[model samples]
Target chain A: MLLEKLQSAVGAGVILPDGHETFVLNLGPQHPATHGVLRVKLTMDGEYILRAEPVPGYIHRMQEKMGENRSWSKYLPNTSRIDYLSAMTYTHAYVLVVERAAGIEVPPRAEYLRVITSELNRISSHLVWFGAFLLDLGGFTPLLYAFDDREKILDLLESVTGSRLTYCYYRFGGLCNDVDAEFLTGAREFVAYMRPRLAMYRQLVTDNIILRKRLEGIGRIDAELCRKYGATGPVIRGAGVANDVRRVEPYSVYPLLDFKIPVYSECDCMARYLVRMDEMEQSLRIVEQAIAQLPEGPVMGKVPRVVKVPAGDYYHAVEAARGRFAIRIVSDGKEIPYRIKLRTPSFSNLSLFEEASRGMMLPDALALMGSLDLVIPDIDR
Target chain B: MTPTLDELNQAFLRLLTPAPALGTACEMHDATSCEGKGVSPNPAPTPPPTSAPVPPCRIVEGKTKGYHFDADLAPDQIVPAGRLLDERGFAIDAVTGVDWLAAGQMEIVYDFYHPVSVLHVVLRCRVPREGAEVPTLSEVFPGANWHERETHDFFGIRFTGHPDLSPFLLPEDADYHPLRKDFTGAA
Candidate 1:
């Protein structure tokens, strides 16, 4: 029944033209390898995949429709839910767009604080991806170590934002509250503690021969493919483009601090893995610099209680853990938005999967998906 | 090395003018390399062309608007604009639709971003609310396939040449356009 359904839905393309038999396989909606409720229909001939059609929307929440109905301030919390793994960065994009459209001025201290918290959030998010990705590759040991390190970040963020996972901490022009001295000291200590662990991770997993063999030449997404598919974050960086929102777009206090954008030209799974691993260290550097340059002022900026965005469209983008998360708002000079569009990176990243995974072994395709570091809700949003 | 944002801005400005001949336009583009090398640093001595085919879209300050360039184009001009952006190494960012029920019109907005130069351009086209249609950009930017589909699912704006117009982020059997302001969730 499943084969019949898939064959009819996907059409004659599923059956090979040269009289070889092909079977349809559903990867998820319940499978653990998928990370969330994403379903990819694979038309397979023996071990090789003929086609990979990702059928997303099992977790679709119509978040954009909800945005139009909610008032400006009332809709802020929804941003955190878009991509729960890197919730702070999603919130950063939302708040930045709103602040920019309304012409609100954030304090220098608040900008620094935003940078510190978001970078820490980025580190924590990457750690989750590290563990989850290794777990996908059948390595249980790294998952434990990655999560153990990730817990420290969650604890530090929880102390300040009061939420570990989906933090609704950022406001229109600034943050909801200030980071205390204890939080600062904790962040500094965490950065110092994380550096050695990253090296340890490199020694333990990155240098493993079996792991390298599995990922090195698998899923070769060249620079032109990335451009055609709009792949970014570590994916494009892995293809030798030094494209980073912090460096290119220059948001927050990033220009005031210093960090390197890791680029690896291999355009394979290993290259993406290396780029992300290097990015964690860079994020930590940013966190440390932001803490050291932490200015003194109120965390929240002054503005009218109800933010009435001017009658126009506004766009803002930030580098999330997965890639570039952008938000577009069409306001009618009212408290309620006319339309809201959340351009989640995972959506664009996953869109390229079908084209990239064509003609690959099933296991290799899964490895490529793991390298993408997708959060399904972000795609379905 | 990649061209600076200023060079890209100049390349974009040059492409906006109506090409006198296809061969001549290609030669002019070849003369001003997409990379920073070989392109003149100074502005053109001649005044801007007044007889451009499409309405002029100016590159603005990134501060006032969140993006660098904003172009309001007719529905037919999107493909040409997308082709020029693709040639200049800009990636398709997002395709969004805004329903203007009061104005009885719908707006389809396409965003493009240059990975190296960090320039962002937004192209917007307004169509009538009923039977709204625009040319597909998927041929130019394959990345636009899903975005265009998602926009269609939300606003029911047809991309005439899109390969697949099926539901994205919506149930396969869904018939309602939920993002439209008039949609009230009634079965």
Candidate 2:
């Protein structure tokens, strides 16, 4: 019966035609559409997916488990790995939760530094999302185009944080290094430099009707449905819900930066595209503001050589490029956290795919998955 | 002055803000304490040090003392933290289940954010170790279904009314809450 059900889902036959009835296909642990080591077992009826079941844990590093072993300070690195593309945002969530629990007041200058770097990280993330989203849609050119500008932001971040991908630059109190005046000036110049490029992105992708036909209404997540599933980032905003972690709960220098959280109410794939495209521009503006008012101060707070957060729970969320990133940390009066739980935005956002994809074509489903903009590690974690 | 989450919390307490069950969380403290992410409050009056220590309770029957957070909702409590979080403008980020073997018991943590409030609220409900169960919030927040499913998958806890309780990020019959202290199982 199980085999028959699987076969029917595959749609070849409830009974075998040539000994074997089902067209079982594994859309793999490495397939581009699988989004990084995700294996979705698809029992198919020709090109149509009859049954699609997701398989996770291929790269399950057990970050939450690792938090139990490492102290609060030692576990920050783990955040970067969950959604490596949005590492800084993950670490920001980690540090902020500690700050809230322990009452560590991050100074004004520190907040500006955080904003400059985080916004740059946001730009870097969106650039990748933009490129990758397009790449998924079958146009490979935009990937490289998005990366060119992303390199600039990456270089700027590398100057301060020292590493590109899994940066452990943020301390509970401040940054690991100060923002040099030259770096500050360069960051300011870069944002000013990238202004028109964003408009170009709109023309190249956002305004393209062909792209719209592929995305526009392909994955229509209604406003009520979005909230029901706890979607965030552009997915929720696209549904006409004005909910952004940065705007709703202002953190760092965001309250001072004077940038609007872009929200589009269309609740479709195209709406998500527009929301993300507009957000990158808003991120640039925030980065510019931070560099303009870049106050002079020590980048690292007066933290002891070995950082130790006191006992009790600390939960903090950051507006990652994708959505709200909530980190719940419990320290056992040690350097590491007794327990650390990451509430990744991508995981929840991706769930909408199940509802949004029902009764949709395979291409439409892919479009819906792409539009959700989730990184699997974030989901698996 | 732009208000922060800390200021909001203080105002909530002063105005007798009903201890609703959810709020937003942030990674960085914005401008000042007022704008940081959601933080569970300590019962003590004074703010604790960054490295403040909590003594681990002696292992009583292989478990620590479980604390109950029964924050009674006032009858006219207009903003029941849980309902408002899903009804109007809030976006649920992630739901967390905190299992404290050292302190004992488990805390079901819900993080919520309203774009305009500029406030993040964290609501945590507690359940004991032997039979941990909570009402499914999936009926309220569709996103909670995934979170609740993942929590059920990893922690091996049951959400009594969860519509679908299959393993989301785990193998169908895998038996291990990898996040639990005694977990060694995997898919």
Candidate 3:
């Protein structure tokens, strides 16, 4: 049926020298360039793609269904599972909606701690993206460097959160636990250590002509396209729109901290690449400032014993590693939520691939996909 | 030129203002009736019977509420709302359904965020649970294609005029909608 729609839109095919027409090529569900089990059914006319339809849902966990079944507090652990790459931010978004609905006041110290940990997580997420993305583009060394830096962040986070990957660190009103002085000192040292590494990464990967040729002027997505598809975070930032949720929507203690939303108007893969690279530096800055201005107070907020959110709907979004990760909760003034929608950014970001990758070379299209910094579990959720 | 939250709020009000005679009666009609009623059966249009003010279809500014501007719109009003918000440079965030099973109604919620400003606009419309359907916003906001399909997958809500409503995040051949309150996992 997708083929019929494509055929109706762009004829049956372009006759090749070999007398064959455009044929369908299933790209993933298990391919390295995809980064996960994301399949793209590409109707290829030789090396160029006529259309690229991403077949998602290879890992649908019914995350939203679980939200309805479980009690409000019981669903906290599931938030991290939606997007493992940036579990803290995803958890923060879920925690926020419930807090707002229940009228729970998170303490100032907890807010600052949330900001510090989230920014550190963002840097780690970006580092993984930086490495995996470079690896996707055929540069393996950066992944090693990227994970090395990322490992330090994981260690710091693990000291507080306990788990390394799918972190259920954030609680209803505040965080699961308070960050001690040792964790704070480790974060500060990690930030200082990461600054020069970013410069080195720019020298090693961004300066390379091969990566430049692979990314520059390839898979160019403008601001209008982003708005149409609701593509957020670095994708929109790379398109020159400073739509960062932290800056635009003053959630957490972000309004108190000063940071620049790295926007590049070039709207190419390179622009998206450069945006993520610069964002890590900016995350380091926020982590640095947040630590220095860290308040002396309690991390956990006062709350009722049995959590029952009021009968109303609430929406809260946080700047996750991929984009603006949002959560919409419909409560029935009961312990269990009526409905919960986890709006993962990659879901929206990946939706744009079909339209954006039209008529582009397969390699360039994959480069564009890598630039999207997709976590397939997030999209599949 | 990023419009401030106030500007966007005012713009939404101006767009949603009742068009004199063409008031809220249009809310009850389904998509087929709304589309077919382009050529009204009655040649001479009669003035709306009720002088009682149109309910708050306008955007409600609420800092306490999760969204800055929350409006309960009629099912038919979603497309125009989408167009107005789209023109105002608001990006389509997410579209999902809420099942008020006890009320025998299903509510479709559309969340929109301004790319340049600090505003989250939520548009919600309720329809009867049996044979639930709403006009597609995929034409207005292409990003809504997957969202609408996912909503359909979970709640069995049909998005009329959706290019392809093939099951998203569900098996293509799957016949069950799992997220409905009464859905039993018997199969």
Q: What's model 3's TM-score?
A: 0.91
- Among these predicted structures, which one has the highest lDDT? 1
Chain B alone, TM-score of each model?
0.74, 0.57, 0.76
Per-candidate clash tally: 0, 32, 0
lDDT of 1 by residue, B1-187 (tens): 4445566556655655554433333332233221122223442432333444333455667895788776665566688879978888889999999876655567788988888877898877766689999999999999999999999998899999999999877899989889998999938
Q: What is the full ranking by TM-score, best candidate first?
A: 3, 1, 2
lDDT of 3 at B104: 62
Give candidate 3 misplaced runs (Cα > 4 Å).
Answer: A1-20, B1-54
Q: Which candidate number would show the highest DockQ if scored against the true structure?
A: 3
Best by TM-score: 3
| Candidate 3 residue lDDT tens string, A1-381 | 996696666556666787658878888889988888988999998788988999898898889989888899899989988888898899899888888777899998889998888888898899889888988888899899889999999999999989898888888778878988999999989988988898898898899989998999999899999999999999999999999988887788999998999999999999999999999998899999999999998888898999987776778888998999999887766688878988989999999999999999998998999999999999988
Give the distance in Å from residue B58's predicted Cα in candidate 2 to where it truly belongs. Answer: 29
* Model 2 agreement with the true structure over B46-130: per-residue lDDT tens digits: 2433452221111111011111111212222213445644544555656777665433445566666554454445555555545
Q: Write the per-residue lDDT of candidate 3 for residues B51-129, one digit (tens) a residue.
A: 5543434444345466777655666778988998887888999998887665566878899998988878888777878
Q: Indicate whether candidate 1 or candidate 2 has the larger DockQ.
A: 1
